[model samples]
Target: MSEINLTIDGRQVKAEPGMTVLEVARREGIDIPTLCHHEKLEAFGGCRLCMVEVESRGRTSYAVSCLYPVAPDIAVRTRSEKVDKIRKLLVEELMAHAPDAPELVTLAREYGADRNRFAREASFCVLCGLCVRYCDEVKKKNAVSFFDNGAVRQIKFVPEVAKNECWNCQECFAICPTSYAQAAYLLTEALAFPGQHQSVKRATKAAARKRVVIPIAPVPMTA
Candidate 1:
């Protein structure tokens, strides 16, 4: 790919074509926090935490760095008064959903976000889609997906696939920013397949029974 030139945080940088502004900034050691953007998955832009100020044609505007491609001669500001203020607001909003997430708490401290700025929502999911996208794109296992929409939207595991696949692969758990994906799956398993654990235990016992040979002590005793 051809090299593209862009200015990020007042520093001239060169990036490859098709690279997003966040990629360039990260390459140059510019720290732009992100929630949904993962290197292995497509940009969902679900979380606006990475919003940055972009200057093109002498006009400034906001853009999600992960979704915004780096264009030639474009100037990007990873942080500014407005960008910080916006990020702080975004952090507050996300904190309402996952108030105890370590990453969110860290960002809240950095941005001076008020955890209780918004009413408490114990859903504990920021809807970053990292789990869903990672499971689909990287693992090629469409076990988990988003359900519903708008305010009540949630992520759920497909019962059939999740029962067989999720136990073998919890890769999505690693990518979740709020760490709620595993909890969500466990809750689903409990609700959808109440006997799943019992079934596994029975299977294990049956397997053990097959190996249980009561010892060949009779042959020695006869001798």
Candidate 2:
């Protein structure tokens, strides 16, 4: 494939045809925030926070950097007035779900997004799909996925798969932007699969039944 040259934030860079705009911009040390895009996984534009202004053939538009491909001879602006406004709205929207998320808070500061702009519907999940995508794409474990549709959608673990898989492997927990995947999994473990590992649960309950550690004060000093 021929080299693709593009201008990102006024810096000229050469990239391969398959590389997306976000990859090219990152190659040039450009900072583009994204909650969904992961290097190990395929480009998922679930979070439009990485939107950027693109000018091609005198036409200007915004595109999600993680999913949008780099076009030869196109000018890309990572930050712009319109782009910032769009990002600010996005931040505000996502913050509605995960108000206290560190990543969202940081983005709120940068984009001047007011967390309270929308009604407080704190589910503590921004639905970035980081955890779900990582679980499926990288770990190859379809243990968790988005449950429901529309406004009530949330991530959930398949009780059977989670019972056998999640306890030993929690790789998705670290990648979650809102830190809700862990808690969601725990909740699912509690309610979704009641009889899963009953013996283990019973043993844990039995162990918790008031065992006083009797301290023997210095067992009779050496003869």
lDDT of 2 by residue, 150-192 (tens): 6576666676677778889999878887667766666555444
Residue 81, model 2: lDDT of 90
> 1-223, model 1: which lDDT tens digit per residue?
6788889989999999988998889888999999888887888888989999999999999999989998989999988999999999999998887887889999999999999999986777788998888888988988888776565777777766776788879888888776677666665555454466865454345324322111111111110
**Candidate no. 1 TM-score:** 0.85
C-alpha lDDT of all candidate models, in order: 0.79, 0.78
Q: Which stretches of candidate 1 lie over 4 Å from their true place?
A: 149-151, 195-223
- The CA lDDT at 10 in model 1 is 92
